[model samples]
Target chain A: MSTTGTAWTPERRARAALTFICEPGRPDLSRFVAEQGAPDVVEALLASSGTAAWSRRARCLDLDALIARAEALGARLVVPGDDEWPAPLAELDRIEPVGGMCGAPLALWVAGRRRLDEILRPGYGALAIVGARACTRYGQALATDLASRLAGQFPVISGGAYGIDIAAHRGALAAGAPTVAVMAGGLDEWYPKGNTRVFEQILDEWAVVSELPPGMRPTRPGFLARNRLIAALSAGVLVVEAAMRSGAVNTAHWAGALGRIVMAVPGPVTSGMSETPHRLIRDHEAELVAGPADVRALLCAPGEQLEGPWMTPTRPLDGLDPRLLAVREALPGRGSLTVDQLASRARCTSAACDGALVELELLGLVEQDESGRWRLRRPR
Target chain B: MSTTGTAWTPERRARAALTFICEPGRPDLSRFVAEQGAPDVVEALLASSGTAAWSRRARCLDLDALIARAEALGARLVVPGDDEWPAPLAELDRIEPVGGMCGAPLALWVAGRRRLDEILRPGYGALAIVGARACTRYGQALATDLASRLAGQFPVISGGAYGIDIAAHRGALAAGAPTVAVMAGGLDEWYPKGNTRVFEQILDEWAVVSELPPGMRPTRPGFLARNRLIAALSAGVLVVEAAMRSGAVNTAHWAGALGRIVMAVPGPVTSGMSETPHRLIRDHEAELVAGPADVRALLCAPGEQLEGPWMTPTRPLDGLDPRLLAVREALPGRGSLTVDQLASRARCTSAACDGALVELELLGLVEQDESGRWRLRRPR
Candidate 1:
């Protein structure tokens, strides 16, 4: 266990202890974690339980040792104070001390090409794609499309799992966008071994991360626990395809809890793989996203469209020209005001008003009847 | 043409006119209708623009004549004010009027053994089954399963088209929940003609509704328009199977807009037809639904738990001792309290406090740790 970096401090011990108790209740882990962070209690538990064997197990999996394992591989340990820390993650601690799969990472072990702080800064597009381990072609294709296109635009975050998640990572990697895989087990072992090549490829070009210490084996619960971190770290979560009961649904729940946008793609009626995402949308728990435009709405920074859709330059009022702003302002109420009435009120000669009206009409502020009566056009 | 009862009055004409304007861009037609109601407007438009004479080519079809045609077959027109109007349709007035492939109907014409309105109510359990006109065997099978079994609980709403929709209708008819075929054309011309027998069977026992007038052919647009009414009039919309751009996608979209629950049965990843619903879920636009339980959530009246998952009831509190109350009061503000700490504040014997705390824990108000700590639980 002696690889690199400093030894585990008492505070670091508490973080490891807290996460162990964070498991679905020995009926009281939350209270204990709340009173004193889990790591703090782990120190006490080992001392008070008076079990020498248990204390040895705890010391064997020390945070410093865990950090050193990654450090030996040229990785950096990012605690809450690091500039690279994601602010959205810290928000998770306020609720239930640490909750769901989306909890703030106690410490992140990063060995990658892209910098975490760079992506976290405004303007870098990052999306998380997660779904059923068993997915339909629809899910795979969409996951690939999103990952490829989004990675070209921004980095993509996801768990290094199978099916939809794997496709998302592969898609982004192929498109040359930075991709990150958050694992449930230690980086030493990529679960499903088949994805090891992809996991390696991602680490070579981007980053592959894990909250767990080295040598820890994967379990069903650990995978469930991994979903929250996936949701918490991304700007939004896109469920590719999943069973109604899949962990992707858990990711969606975590995203919603974090106030992060949750989006799901739809599938054909016959695909069992699409159930999880469909359930979220049908319940109004998530938005129906058909394309990247929908995801853009959920994002924080602006893209493209600078002048905005509504803003227009003011026209000259002095001109006798009807194609200017004078005719538009001359209209009485927002309701259907007739053009002829506007001309009369604006004191513009009928011919001038008519010309101005056409220009205003081009600007989309007024409309006319089939019979040629003029009226104010309501903005859509 | 003989209707059950109608000589014509201002109110009936107003109701019919209201239905007409509910369609997109038809709001302009509202003023003309309001200025003259139905019969008078029809007569006025005819005289003023020679609207009827120009329509001899058949594009500007008369809606009243559509009603008159249904009446000739012993069917009556049902409007929002009608006793047979489906109440679920009330949602149409709230949203920004959904349109296209799945647009809502303005007036429904019915010739049926079962009342349309009674069959669509949530408590009665109506499920909408729709999909691509061309469907895979998997889709067809799921449609049948949904229609056949869920029919025992409620009526199945579907477009009386080919493939998946037809299969669902057949399943419901076989199950005896009383199915309704929302058509794209009038009852006189079954359009697809291949479905003529099923159309006729439904005419005698169920309903076939369309916003399109009688004698007017079912155009592609007409089919798109008819899909929405199917969505709005049902407790939930279920897409058994669909391609990326299939008609079932339209039905799902309408369901989302109407705020009615939209569910899609899952299928295999290999099928291309699974794309749309899978996309719906991935995009967070629809729910992944399986069997009757998923449908039941949509049909569940506000507060009644109907079958399966998330239906656990509150634990009861029949007995509470004072020591437990004191300990509960001593718990930290959104904080975790230990068992030993709780005992110190209770002003009672540690044994009594521990006993009281255990009962409180079982009742779910307070939770404790494996390390013998206790704390308040969040309300959720």
Candidate 2:
């Protein structure tokens, strides 16, 4: 097999066959593949000389049929040394194992429009947005808003579940940005038939990826194994809302164990859906985030200038009403002004100016003094 | 002037007279009283040798009439050296000044049935519950629950206003515990007449206190000054809910400045009332508390056993349903059991056992395994 170009090598076929034989996040198989190369490990497994578990599983595998099935589904296999493979997945080998799960996939089956390397670049990384499948309206709204605002700068990644995940993907797509959906099942069949519309939309513009080959079904272990890939692929993870012992909390734990920044949006303490987020924030395991700015502040470098949502300076002043703009401009450069004095300078009635001052204060443009005088707050 | 006995000494009369003369939390007068004693400071103010502001206000003071008015209003003055004076007030002299306000009150004009010293003992301390005057129903409910649970072991102190304060005092009174209402105005006249019913109930069983003498109205500065007394008098402060710029945030700042444990309850992000609590928790100014247990966990010292509310071990298991108890008892000692296995062991249907497991999981009595099995969580 050639080292470069579009031709398929023997080693590539062996890696593709291994994805169907062993489950994802198998540390022993991953380590074996790393040390002995894919073709050698595949030959050893075919010999049936490995452990009882591996030998028993290998006896039923057919390598050529799996490769043909992947091709029939229009899925391309990307191995570790492929040009389109993400480099951050290598960090999985260093993290402590969780729930008898560890290590990166030896091969990934990609079946979508966008290239993985182009979307998940080296300097600019993707953000994983995960939450409860049975979410409240508040959680859905916040997830949509955060995803829409962040999509322009970063690729929104999620597990493509029903509530929060579909909302996030729809938000990013609404903003005309590409979003990747990592599926637990094969690309041929979406695990949740209810989310077929969102899955189709994601395949049109971005990618739907999985470690399992075509014709394989999603299992309990498959979903848990997929969470590590979501955490390892993203620069940071933002949990919109989750229950006490849900899958989202499991993903957050993986994010933390991988040394990635973990953030959670706070919700009403009265809701059962907010329990995990509240526990994460209350126990100091995750930073509290309200919007895209808070997410960027935690994910980006200190001096990196964020560009979307409220970060743009021109938008805040331009969005103000005429009366509010007049009131903001009427304040003195150094001293403060009372209601009557501001009314005279702004060329409006005192009541109108007072109402405008309250709006301005909410926008953080002005502040009230102890003597009930109004002054322009210094620019941050 | 006699130094002892039940008879009112001349110095005691001078301290009583000072309560009517100076405003509460007046650093200048507090320092003067501390250095020169109450009688000497009263003499200097009467001779018009003090600052222009004090001399101008002192000229209108009639000490005898003021004392008679307090007596008619059923109020008595308690000074620093009195046995009924709260010792925590002495910490006021050491806290950093806020809003140009500092120092303990020269004397407290108290009216009601309970003794301040006995209610606010040296070992046990009071918890100040303060929030917005215009609060939501959610805030009121949480305030009531926390106060009712905490009132058994600690005195619930608050600024007896219309919303959260009144709710807290009413909760404590409903639990038959002595509560203290620290008023911004004189104890004789409650500031918000809407809360007269609650104020009356508090007076029948607890104490209403203020630094200003009877017949004095509450001013903006007077309200700000009274916040210091609320902070200094409490062992800890719990902010139920507040707007962006409210007095509750100011009280929390004072609590932090006074080295008191500052805590806030989180609410829905959609509501503007949760802004201050969210900001406090986000900025690390206050610990986030959900209910009374979270509050006690922060306020109680290490190894100090908390006795009220959910802290009592006898309450939890006794409150569980029979089905949940049977399911909990069916779990194995070492390994986890599937729902079907638990159902067979507990002699119940699978669906019933499933429901019981969910309820037990919520109560934190049981945990689910990765393979969909149930196990008892180790006791906290």
Candidate 3:
């Protein structure tokens, strides 16, 4: 019989065949495979003493068709000993089960121009940006901005779905950076047809990955299994926005159980989209990150400062005279105001307010409009 | 010599006199007063041994005039060992100085019908709400709502300034509960003038307190000293909204220094007004409180649940099937959508979407308009 490629050793073939018959994230099956080896586990499942369901699926599987489908999609199966396997996934073997699901994927079907191993090596790691599929505009904008800014340094990774996930993918593409799309089903058909364009763009530069074989549709259990893979493949996971009950929260759970840095961006407490992020932060289960700088701060080694423009404590109005500060605060956020109006609002004399405006203008903190009204200068 | 009232002992008079000549928060002076006693300290300052600034101010002091001024304002002095002095202020005596300011006031000038001691006794501790004077409508609204909800159980404490401070004071009064306004200047005249009406209302029910005498005006340093008193008088400090450099941040520092629970409400990250609160929450320096219930949770003894409607983890969408959840999430936040639109958005077939919608409708998670378009039910 013809094989998929020279890289398809007996071990690789066994792992690939197991993906078709055995479900992913089964801790007991994973343990059995780990101790006895994939080939031996497959042999046991095919024997008379094996579970009826596993034996039936094992016997009916068509290996040749699976191999041909993988090749047709430009995907390759990577097993435990392959050079392309992610080192971070090793953590999955040691972590406790979540929702009765645990263990590293038996083999991942990966397709891309770049290697997964190189993308997730030490010093250069991936960050997973996951959130609700029905995200708000604020959440989408923030996720896109954060991903675009960080993708050039660390490749962005996310599920191939809409809302925050698609936005993150588009952001990386906008920045001309590579990004990975970890799908919940067979990557041959990027599940959400709406984001197929984004998936295609990602596949051109980075990769589309999954644990399932071709021709399989995504199930609810498959989605849970996919979240674990996303978490295990990244150094840290940043939850942009999520509801009280969301898949993003589940991904965060997996990240936490894997000992990965779990960070969340805060939005208005008034928004339902902020529920999961706020809950994570309030419970101390995740670090609060306002932007990319905060994410960098937590991901970096201890004692290293998060170096960015925002890291500086030098605010424009810091250390201003109390009178000047009061005058500045009195000015409305949008419109300009006359000295008299400012003084009335600031509760100071008009002369003092005028003097403060002059000083503030000199310091580049305020400006005079054509109408002779003073306003705060926009900060650079 | 004529005295303010029977409560004005020689020791009380000495403490009262010190307020006229000395600034409120001098760590060294506070240590001196603590050790030497207020009467001896006054005599020493009156003698040639006093510093030039202290001696000049002390020598010209007229006891009868001060006493008469106190009675005319309907205010009285509450010295250490007095029944009306807040026991929480004792914490200030043991805490380290922040920015060269420390220790409790020698005596507080207070005005109101309720005894300060009774209001701040063990069971009925106060919460301080502080923020920017030029706060956003969001901040002001949140402050008002939080204070109104919490004041019935806990007397609200705040500064008598224009924005968040006055809003908090007004909210407490709206609840028909007594609230304290800690002033930077003297209680006899509330500064800023814009908030005098609110201050007058507070005096009718609660109290206005300060360390300065009747003739003193608020200076920059006096504002810093006033922050410590607000922190010292409360069980916790809730910063509603503040810029990066704000007096509210200063109060949070005092609260932290005094080991008081420091909590902050989160707003939109796009707003500059949220800077201080976001920073405090990100650095783990302050707990994030979305509402009064969160405040109650932190203030309660460890392990006690924050008992409120929000405390229940039974969300409307909890334990929902994946198909129904997807359909629910697909419905637009505001408007209704056709079945085809939802099915397309949820990446499900029209038949499956229709079935899921029926289940969701039965569960009261979604509703259909007269047009037969489905929409998510607004969470109550």
Candidate 4:
């Protein structure tokens, strides 16, 4: 039985066989498939002598047996033309290989009750929340909160690793929102073993996606290849906490290369985990995101404002009365000035200045020091 | 007795009277001083009718008495032409007024053991480290460490307030380096009585300077006016920690307006004190600085690097061995790949890949996962 349509076409079955034969992100194979089509490329590889890596790898593959194993594990092979395939993955075809890895997967072994296209639709995109597996408590908390807040508006996508990733998925699940786990291994095996429960929960409600066929163990290259998928699939990638050299930073680089927004949450400079975020922000590689509102503001369309429940209404200073606005402007951006000093600068009488200060104080627009000086209140 | 030269000139005496009569940074008086010269402007103001603010204020001044009082308080008057006057203050004369305050002080009433000119010279320019008076313990510690680290190369300049300022001065003093306190009020009366001991220590070892004459109290405007002096006196301004509306941010603005390097140390975002630093860094108004090395790197002329004591030598990745570099380039920026996976990507035999991995691991260029996969080590 075909999972994508009424029946699997020759091209679709060939693409499925190619996934088992060639490793994910083989640029040579992808170029061949793009130029000659999957069925032609598969036939050429299978019939060739042991001259190329693909031919040697394909010689041992039992295509029918591999397809049967995927079906038995309740996985569906979704190729590029499938209705369940995410459209954003097509962007990967244009990216030059990074670390000898490039191009869209030949076929995705997807296991979930939900459809991938519906979860990652046009307006409702996915946000990849990723960070160090050994992240600090602060990093974990920020990742969780950010994911939970954005989950309703967008699917929270992440690798199913410990620390930040687990926290993000759990946060989305706790909010009863769909979250996707883009794994480095096959759909049948949970790589970390420690996160088996989280993987099970994601499988129950969301999707666990892989490029490899059933029972194939995760390789280091597979994880790096997997990062590109996470970057391509999401509208933006938010690095909550990472060391100076981390996989999260790698993901951010991929996001940037793909022209996606790369944002990072800042932490104390003293923590080793905060180094990547600080460096990214300092080098202008990533924008600094304080909370969910900042993330929403960056990702959403200009006129489409989505205020999270946790965000406070930001009252614009321009809405204040002209006199009050003048008074506020006269106050030093830092430090205090007395009413008389403020009056002279604000071009008003002492009485008028005093009245404005009182009104401003009542509105929490200004504050008075112990020495009876006035200054603008800092907006939260 | 004169501190700067053989004897104080009549022009110097005129400037001293101007400081007592006109408030610091009055653009009208500053313009008058700039156009007519300090002595001529002082004469004109004292002789004129009560129309303009400067003339009205000047009419009541006892110029001789004010000079006598300053001398009696062991304070020497330093005019623009005096050797003791810091050259950087000239930038103030060119700055367009901010909040009705601008221009160089007519004269500074200085009281200290160390000479002002010697402490704030061209090659050994001062660094202004300012922050919140109500700062956190973390802020205080950072202020102290940064001050102490830079003290050997640069004199520390700050307002002698209760929190960050006092800590900065104490840190510099502990390092046995000269520190300058640019106070708002006269040197005779320490503004904040609580910081009297620190002020005494500073006066005994360094310098306590003010635009206001002896016995005059600090007005709210005087403090605001003093901030510009702090900004103008330094080569750069490093905001350690500040609230949203802090004097440190005001100082940073002045530094920016005067084309000085403005730097800020990042702290935990959860703290209210970090708001100003984060805002400055986030807005690109200030460069992010974690320690003295960053400060040195920014302030030093291009190719005139001064390595800080705490800085570590950074090795360039391009300097690695050829085969090792090839293996490194083959590794994904994030995640791992097994020996076989790596060999295929590196275009080398499995045995060659294993040898390179061992060499790379020894060099701390790469690390192995629990599954014996290899990945590049993130550089600090």
Candidate 5:
């Protein structure tokens, strides 16, 4: 299984083993591995290390069994040199540490039909939508609607949790677009167990990835470390709803550290679930996004006009010349106005008003009756 | 009556008559009045001008009747040099015009018990809360609550309209604070008679102001002109809810142009009323505020610390050393750990972990069991 031609190499084997030994995003270990190469670092650690946590985890060797378990689950190990490895994840090593966590994953256990790198490539980026597990219905509906509208263009990414995360993934699925889940623990078992159905559907159409090897349960530090991956793997992160102390805010922190576009959806200030998002927006840590069009305006490539109608819905009288617009607004809602009366109300000279009236007439926005009094063509 | 103390001077009478002649916010007339004193400009228009709107209205002047009606309504005219005139209104002359309307009012008809200058003086500011007349319950509740909370510190200002305006004024009155209503028309009769009760209460306890004199009705242009006064009188303007084309957005624009702090309260994205607030926040035209505390932070004098408990609620272990925080987070919720075990999970050296545990013990955050394992002092 560790042979050539689609099989794991020595470097891949060492990286896979490292995931089981050292915790994800350990700066010291990652730096050491980067300097000395993974296989050499693994060799040195396994040879002379005593009671150190990495050595202890390494002494009990079950590399073959771990690989077999992953294979049984139809999961594959993707290391740094793999063609399917995401390019954006490389940014994690360059960004400053966040919450005592940093560094890209040594290896990822990927379980899915879709290619991880394709959907997340530059110019065609991914959006991560995250929020509270006990979000309000407003949050849930907004998350779903925003994801559904944007996922067709930008693949949605999120943790496969109960509330906002699952809603985002479901929204993407509803749009017939593949979504990605970056998990904190092993790919063999879904963490919550309640989301097994959604997890299964994701595996059928998209991808679920973890930095931890098979048989490892999630830890508090693991979730924080996993957030860095979520931030690094996407072009932008949109926080829908979150409490002050939540994984979603931590994810936004990571996204900010990685220089990813951080956006937040505004909800009722009365809702506790919206506290973090509102705080982020108020503090200038995140851009306030109202809907999918706003999300696209920030995430889409420059010169790309992908915004939806909600961005700036044109009223019937939009785009009119200022003089014409003023003349139209000056016209009475229920009664007709003579040219002089309209000119005075609009603060325009008679010549300017006459010019505006002719243009307004050409646009079919206003009409003059036989008595020469002007009113709206379609009065409200 | 026109010659004694608190009586109208030639300049004051000229300004009073001009209010009934030219429309409010007419740049040309306001500039003419500013360049040539009001008394001289009024004489010129009333003497020789013909067929021009100002001259036409000037020729039909019933100055005594207008003055008598204002006196009957208990409304007094305040002009530029008056002691009670707001200094902020002077900025209107320098700002670029909006909607073809600009310039300070020739005179303001103020009806209230409270002195406008005292409440709106520098270092002690007023807040303008405006929104759509057809607002949601969420908007209504937020407007009322925000106004109530902020009005005590800063007098609330708003339009005397049906929905958010009336709600905001009522909130201020409920808090036993004065609120000012900047109306589009005469202060003699409330535009929306449905709000007559609230308007009467305001006139009794606070103020109802307008650039238009008594007997003048509000027109489409008059409302646009009125929004400028709401912006000019406040230190900050907070848009609670508004459609894209509503007066609240226009007030926010005036606030920006006047170099005043512009703020907006966020609500549900599904609401049309929240659209303008969200758009303003998204475009960086306004800051997103959750409630009163945020409004105060932006509006309060420099170096003032008026933030509330909701600003940043401190948790029990918030100020702990990073090593101790990391160690605390690493400990399992249901179990205890040895120093070495904790160090490994916390990604800290064993010596560092031992130091952190000692400090954690001193803070009563963690303790050692009989078997010498560390656990939380108040375990969840």
Candidate 6:
């Protein structure tokens, strides 16, 4: 499938896949579908050889009613290659999926004005805040503070499970940034049911969405499915609270496989909830983040945001080279410029300006990170 | 000058170095101290060249106490290369005590039953469990569980601070294994004071120890000093719970420099308590541990606990080949058979039996984590 855009449509591929997985031995069929691609996934289900595996792919669920329900909720279906699709998730196809960790979304049904891809900026990458269903006050408070502090930077993504997940979504909402919730079951049912009011409120402002088929019920497996999406869609997945054998770790592993940043909050070594994140980090699968600043800096990463030509400084007009002086004077409001752009404006080729930009960067003549497209270095 | 395990007794020398650190244009004293050997470090402090630095070191109350109180506690000041020292802790000597990040101990006033050297068994290593002072339930629980489980196989080390520290010590004690509590302050005031019961108990049953001297109240800097000891004395350091810039991670970095395994217990990504561990693990500076089995399997590192010898039963049976067969036949319940003692009775030469033992090990017939000179391998 050419992934530039337009590959996904309302084909019930998600429902088809769900139907297939719900059957006996069809879980293994995911491998075949992944290798063969989506259309082939349906073909495999239809194949006589695969009939024994799923046996129920032909059973038609009322897909239209489900679509109508989501529509009534004002949700939109986000498929692969769509303009709003999360590009980082492309790693899902390249990163060798381990176990059932492969993340190929049938579609991410969304219900908000916020675009999934836009939130995943170079510096302010999306933060996935997930944890135990039974999080403590320590976990809740920390989650709230982190989400609040990071509100202006990274929007939070989480399951609407109680405890840490709810805390994260609440934290982000409080920060006035949209938080997205990926549900385990159909967005219609609101699996926990208790969080229905919160879900409606969230739907009103941000997004409450899922990959599960419209009528599909939440199961242990569906939770697993939901987790992979949460991890895959973000630039980094941060597990707030996970027990020794938590499902949250499965998400972390998916993020690791996708090469997305996997971060885990550490807890008392005594708590069962702290185990999974510790394991992910200790195994060198994730990065530790202290707060918004660390996450913000890392999200910028190496070579992401450049401040100057980062090659050499342009000499001043005081006995300095004329080319350097020209470029330096052209800076608007003391704004910085890169070598190539500066070269064009200074009436010189990039070769000459590159050398000048480096000196400026080192001399603290410019600042970087907020904009890779350089800026005048402001002193602290 | 020699590491008579009493190097810190030359108190004037340590004072002088502290003085130098407190002087002008000496922000990088840790690097300088690290370059100098223990005796050289002590001497540099005592010489006239260090007078400017000495006055600064002399002003600190804890600095004054380290010389006198460290001795009073029956704590022989242990430094790197001392015969009575732990090999794992050799890394501490490499760090200069600047900004409390990489400094090796000026001296470790150890007071306990287990000598540092004896516990430094090649295979059975050490681990440090550290975390936030105002830790969460999740954080505390994880720290305790990790410590208790690891205690059976390796010594658990910690800062002996509040929250997570208290939990780790209690866990180890509950497991009936002695733990090393590396304190920031002198033994007199257990800083938090709430932990006085356990602190005093440790001095009796285990050991409440530090690099600082007796009566030296824990300064923010001294607490940082205590972190290095926790890092160095262990084969690895496990950060249980910490905010992004929390002190526990400093120990992790120290352990990283020491080339020790750094592990972290993960919590809810939402919880700030988990920030440090997540950061360390995410950055690949620490390993993630899910449970006791995970830590034990990693730290104890059970190698090929499979059954079966590589070769056939025996090729070179010597004279007692048939007798060795008889001994095998005579076995009812599993038991240990001393090399010569079993050989003499079986009428086989000790040399022949020794070869068989090596072969047995290779074949996976028996395994040994307890390295021994003539150790008996339990039957597979």
Model 1 earns a TM-score of 0.58
Candidate 2: segments with Cα more than 4 A from true spot: A1-5, A49-51, A308-380, B1-6, B49-51, B308-380
Write one digit per residue (lDDT tens) for candidate 2, span B226-321: 888888889899998899999998899889989998988888877888888888888889888877777767877764554433122334664356
DockQ of each: 0.19, 0.45, 0.47, 0.34, 0.65, 0.32
Candidate achieving higher TM-score, 2 or 4: 2
iRMS per model in Å: 5.3, 1.2, 1.0, 1.6, 0.6, 3.9
lDDT of 4: 0.82
The per-model lDDT (C-alpha) reads: 0.66, 0.82, 0.83, 0.82, 0.84, 0.62
lDDT of 3 by residue, A254-349 (tens): 999999899988888788999999889898899888877677667766644322221223356533567778999998889899999999999999
Give per-residue CA lDDT, model 6, range B1-380, as digits (tens): 11134444444345323432332213244446556643465544445444464643543335444545545655555554567556555455454543535544444566765565544455556668888889988778777877775665677778777889889988888777667787776656677888877766666655556665555567776676667677777877878788988888777777776777877766666677867776666666767766665665556434422111111132222112343444443332455556666566556677876665566556444333443423334544
Best candidate per lDDT, number?
A: 5
Q: Model 1 interface RMSD, in angstroms? A: 5.3
Better of 5 and 6 by DockQ: 5
In model 3, which regions exceed 4 Å deviation? A1-6, A47-51, A303-380, B1-5, B49-51, B303-380
Identify the runs in model 6 with alpha carbons over 4 angstroms from their true place.
Answer: A1-103, A106-125, A303-380, B1-380
- The candidate with the higher lDDT, 1 or 4, is 4
| C-alpha lDDT (0 to 100) for residue A65 of candidate 2 | 80
Higher-scoring candidate on lDDT, 3 or 6: 3
In candidate 3, position B126 carries an lDDT of 79
lDDT of 3 by residue, B1-380 (tens): 11235567778889889999898898767667878988898898788654599888899999779877987888898887777878778788788789989988888998876778756766555789999998999999999988888876667899888899999999889877668999999776679898888888888777888899887899999999999999999889999899999999999999999988999988878788899998999999999888776887888765543222111223566435667888999988899999999999999999999999999998889999999999888867
Fraction of the reference Cα-Cα interface contacts (below 8 Å) that each candidate reproduces: 0.39, 0.58, 0.65, 0.45, 0.97, 0.68
lDDT of 6: 0.62
